[model samples]
Target: MTTPTLGEFGRIARFFKPLAAGFPGARGLRDDAAVFGVPDGRELVVTTDAMVAGVHFFPDDAPADIAAKLMRSNLSDLAAMGAEPLAYTLVTALPRGLDESWLEGFAAGLGEEQRQFGIALAGGDSVSTSGPITLSVTAFGLVPTGRALPRWGGQPGDRVFVTGSIGDAALGLEVAYGRLDIPAQDTRAHLLRRMRRPDPRMGVGPRLIGLASGAMDVSDGLVADLGHLCEESGCAALLHADAVPLSEAARGAIDGDPVRLALAITGGDDYELLFTAPPSASDALATLAADCGVAITEIGELRPGTPGEVVVLDGAGAPLALVRRGWDHF
Candidate 1:
């Protein structure tokens, strides 16, 4: 016998409404739109990111992880703007025959992140789709007036910094694809986690207000994203290959293989923040990293030259040729 299906309203009332609990602005997901007053002395920052099954994530991946990734991806944008997350709206398009259990897990994931990041689900829409699962999150954050980091403020001689080690997510995708043979289980597990879960540098971004001249999250590969910053700021960049921080797991994967190193450089999906600051603020940034309990590394510098030019130099001062910069939507 065919089973009954949970319609849109029923699904929202059963799974999503609880996720919006305690947020008066959400109006229990009953209102047409959420309403909230911005706190005094702060401005709102909004960003949206979308994830699709088989493109952004594996089709069989955990519902919760997929939900978390979508939320974190949007949150990373807010972090790049030096804002703290306040609230978010989620919209999900589910494939035909989607199980109620899947919705439960997805909502649970959103609920968990809401509590962890001190945000709430204001409202959202859920609909069934004939194609793959698609989820979008529009996150809201707040920053002090005129303190949000500017994407176009990077200047020549500004030191480039990145939060946490790089390239783990790229290698993590390799692990997910079963292409890499990592003998160490710990290393494999680490890479897998990096691919499945991304950490948005929310704590560090706030401390960078008025300190960083420019900032953005590294959604694309490092080289490609930095090139974007340069193009926007009308500057070039000279990146030291040796200084690009790598996790122990990534190092192991790249050991003795220069191609693997190149993958680390060009492979995308890292949600870490990439920001430019003056030399004088280096010490302050260091302190901020310490306080945030996340590693910050100096990888390159902006230079006065052709816009969109990104040069990667080896430790011996020789330029390294890269075939691809990072993931491109086109």
Candidate 2:
């Protein structure tokens, strides 16, 4: 069966224009570029994330899930910086012979998430490509001046914490690739959902403005990303694997498999926030987590050691050697 595709102008007029309808600065997406005003006493926070088919996601993945994942990935960065989402510009390099229905589904997904996150589609460009379906989203957000969280600033003795459970996305990728075995249908669904539609920790980020010392979303494996934070702060980290929170499904999959346990720690795509704060903020963090209805776990602490070093230990306190740190795109 032949697929229906739209011309560049036709696609913009039919699909993209409606997304910009109510945003005045977007100029209805008719102009070549968008214009907007920054709020008083607030700083604009900008972030960009791109996902390529067959690299970040499977080519045969659902178009809606792909769109949602792309948006959340960009939003997670803003969340790490303690910002509230405002708008985004999208750019897509679509493959030839793509179905028009795919565009509809993708736009629908984007619209739904935009409404949920209180953001709008400002403007963007779409072009055809012979390669995979690649998507890049440049998201805009706002934070108070001089208050945005940095990747550094954590001191020795600060508590290292993470929001939500880890390893689900990595396991979800395993489930999607048919590399892992799961007999329960519900468990499979949970893992797949975590992979396709990760929550961006939007609510928790705003509340962390005066609390967290340093923060970054866990995109690369937890260990690798935390190592980045450590390097930026000129310190080291001691991560307790036993203290790393995991979804019930993740625990079930690992059971007693040492390899799966390692993957859970090092595998990436867990969009949860990895942050550090002083012990004085523990109660406040707990209160914030409760208010936001997100789980918060103290996995370890930043310490004085070789900068950029991340040491992971087992329950018995023995150092565990990790073969791979996390996902790296060359």
Candidate 3:
């Protein structure tokens, strides 16, 4: 049967209601807003992220593509809190006409992500816009009351860790800008997919929340985002240049320029999680990696002096400095 033509309101309701059905404590989606009570000893960890067309993504990008990214980006914030994915609220502004094709695909994408991340869609707002489309997603998770990971938790000598690969987005953006080209292989398509849609480290969050002294997602490039972490944790970092995992694709694009490599490291939009942990929790990181089946690389450690210094070291542990600035919004 053909699906019903859900206007803005009907579309949002039909998409989210069934997903939150199993979440009894999520208030059944009947009221204006859902109610969530943090478990007796757990604290609510919530984060919101907004992505605007032309700024966050290309205006011509697919609705589902934007939907998937907004979901993952917001969930990554929850990951930073080391919280269990509980629920989320989405706000979207669509441009021009409401076409069935885009709405169906967009709803499917959000629903698929909610199921994948084990979060419910509680509520949100939507409107037609004369400007480009914009999506804002607010995600919430639960963490042990006093133990939710904070950006200020890092201590000197605590080793830093990053999950999954980096620079895919930087290079992906390069592809978008015609600065680089992919090999046109199945693997390259996969890399493009990674650049388009990233799987947030949901399970890894709660695992590292208490142990990770300071944590944040690598949305902006490594240099820029890690600088935020260091500033929050009140420490400096000596990034092992060789230790920074550059995809073979990214390595090829660098043309052997360490400066470009450094730029990729410092560039934003990677969306991977960057965290610092004490040496004592090293074994736990290993176990967590095994359980989650995702890479958790220990790249560097916090230093006492010089906050925002993400030193890139060569294979022999020599320092590599770049004249170029990483990603900057301004």
Candidate 4:
């Protein structure tokens, strides 16, 4: 069956314009650029992320899931900096012969997430790509002046904490690739969902303003991202391998396999917040976790050592050597 195609202007009028209806700054998608204002005592936070069809996701993955993942991943960046989402601009480079239904599904997914996250589509460009479906979003958010979180704020003796379970996304990627065998249908579904649509810690980020010392979302491996924080903060981290939280599905998938456990620790795309806080903030952190309804687990601590060094100790309290720490796009 041949798929229908619309001209550029027709596509914008029919599909993309509605996404800008709620945001006055979008100018109803009629103007060449978007215009908006940031509140008087707040700073604007902007982040951009791009996803390729074969690189970031399977080429045949559902369009809706792809759209959701792209938007949420950028939102995770904003959350890492303790910002509240406001608006976003999207760029779509789609193949010439793609089906129109794919655009419909993609727009629907973005609309749903925009409503869920209280953000609106501002403005952007779309073009035909000779290669594959490539999408990028430049998300804008707001934070109080001088209150945005930094990667260099961690101090020695500060407790390292992570929001939500770790390694589920990596395991889910394995499930998606058919590399891991799991007999349970529910378990497979859980991991796959975690990979496809990450739950960004939106609620926890804004509240972390006065609490967390340093923070970054776990996009790369946990150990690698912690190393980045340590490098910025001029300290080293001692991570307790046993304390890193794992979902029941992830545990069952590992099944006491040390190799799989290491993959879980080093594999990237978890998107959970890895942060540090002083011991004095423990009670406040516990209360914030309960109020936010998210699991915040203490996995390690910063210490005086070589910067950017991350030491992962096993349950026996000995360092465990690994082949690689995280993903590298280079």
Candidate 4 lDDT for residue 189: 95
lDDT of each: 0.89, 0.92, 0.78, 0.93
Give the best candidate by TM-score.
Answer: 4
Please give, for residues 78-145, the per-residue lDDT of candidate 1 as tens digits. 99999999888988998768877887888898888888888898998888889999999999999998
Query: Across residues 1-330, which tens digit of lDDT does each residue of candidate 2 receive?
Result: 446666899899888888877678899987889999998999999999999999888888888899899999999999999999999999999987888888889998888888888888899999989999999999999999999999898999999999999999999989988999899999999999999999899999988888999999999999999999999999999999999999999999989576898999899999999999999999999899899999999999999999889999999999989998888853
Residue-level lDDT for 313 in candidate 4: 98
Query: Model 3 TM-score?
Result: 0.90
Q: Order of all candidates by lDDT, from best down to worst?
A: 4, 2, 1, 3
TM of each candidate vs. truth: 0.97, 0.98, 0.90, 0.98
Minimal lDDT window, size 10, model 4: 1-10
Model 4 regions lying over 4 Å from their true place: none
For model 3, residues 234-296, the per-residue Cα lDDT tens digits are 778888867777677677666545556766786677778899889999898999999999889
Give the range where candidate 3 is weakest over 10 consecutive residues by summed lDDT: 321-330
Candidate 4 C-alpha lDDT tens digits along 1-330: 447788788889988999999999999999879999999999999999999998999988888899899999999999999999999999999999988898989999999998999999999999998998989999999999999999899999999999999999999999888999888999999999999999999999988999999999998899889999999999999999999999999998887576788998899999999999999999999999999999999999999999999999999999989888899843
Residue 176's lDDT within candidate 3 is 74
Q: How big is the positional error of residue 246 in model 3, measured in Å on the Cα after superposition?
A: 3.0
Local error of candidate 4 at residue 147 (angstroms): 0.6
- Rate residue 321 of model 1 by lDDT: 96
Better of 1 and 4 by TM-score: 4
